[model samples]
Target: MKQYTLLLAEDEPFLGKVVKESLEKKGYAVMLAPDGKQAWQLYTSFEFDMCILDVMMPYKDGFTLAAQIRQANPKIPLMFLTAKADIRDVTQGYASGGNDYLKKPFSLDELFLRVAELLKRASPENQPADEFTIGSYSFSPKRQELKDSDGTIVKLSHKESQLLVLLLQNKNLVMDRKATLLKLWGDDNFFNTRNMDVYITRLRKKLHKDPAIEIVNIRGFGYKLIC
Candidate 1:
């Protein structure tokens, strides 16, 4: 089996060791960071398929680290492992760019399942818009450009392009809140959730010129891209 690279950021030594061992046992190549600072450094210096972050830590918090990561690479998968249970925290996590949030004291089995599911969903081969056609909007992943029916071009920021690509890829399917956050932000935290909301709203406005395109919120779930 191919070894998937994972960046694990946890301040608790014992828990980090356990999680690292578990992931390694499952054939993942794990890099452990004991704090947000180290995690950020490692992420920037190396390549990883996904990030698992613990919210509270020394130096910087997980939310800040996740935002930095999203600014650098919006498509990398990110998940939060924290003890916080407040609705605000959950919303923050999603807004920050986290694709998934796993509460602390979670079962190892569930963690493994979540990891597997994220990897499966984010695999490059499964991305939508190998090419996408949205009314007058046309997007080609290979070219990373959006053009109107008249061939007028609309530039997309890196994150915007990635988010649009995901929406197009998962067209009509309910893109779960956690999944989207993890895939983009690297953690699910309050601030990031708000950021995601902003991005969603921006995307809606941009696509509004095309009546055939709509990004529908699935209430407490996620968003659905319809074209």
Candidate 2:
């Protein structure tokens, strides 16, 4: 079994302590933050396999923190722990890059289940291969790097690497748009759709070094990577 590290950001002292201890006992390395600001600090200072965040907190909010984290590491799994029941709040959580949402007064057993599922989905072992070859380029999704034919290495964000891997898998075939959004962003909402478009543009620029390689927009469908 692989060891996982989690970042828990909840302002409530009792809740934070209880969750931390409970997760630690489950064999995870847990780092608890009393506020969103501290959570951001911890996120920058350390690497975490996943983040469990409370929507309401002092100095900053979980949604804001989540956006920051997503920008820094787009592939990391994030879950929201919130008391807000509004449908808009739930929508906002997904828009801000949360992979899961758990309401307050929830059971520890439920939390454990969600955590396990999210980690499993994002686990590297689930990938078919650590590296993939594109036209005139070698891509290592695990390392988030793309090596050009001339040996110039380009660093990629977690999101970019994930997208590249999916494109590779469906090379020359149209990868379904809704399915891609759901798999990467955990939602098929308009916001995630637009976000995926942005990532697609980023990938195009990154892979443009190889004239033989092209990522084509399927127009009302998905994308196809041509090599």
Residue-wise C-alpha lDDT for candidate 1, range 1-227, written one tens digit per residue: 77899999999999999999999999999999999999999998999999999999899899888888988988888899999978688768777888888888999998998899888878977766466787788887667677887778777666777788777768899988876776676456677678888888988877777887889999999999988
Best by TM-score: 1
RMSD of each: 5.5, 7.1
What are the lDDT scores of the predictions, listed in order?
A: 0.85, 0.90
Which ten residues in a row are the worst by lDDT in model 2?
Answer: 179-188
Error of 1 at 10 (Å): 0.5
Candidate 1 Cα outliers beyond 4 Å, as residue runs: 130-227
Clash pairs (backbone) in predicted model 2: none
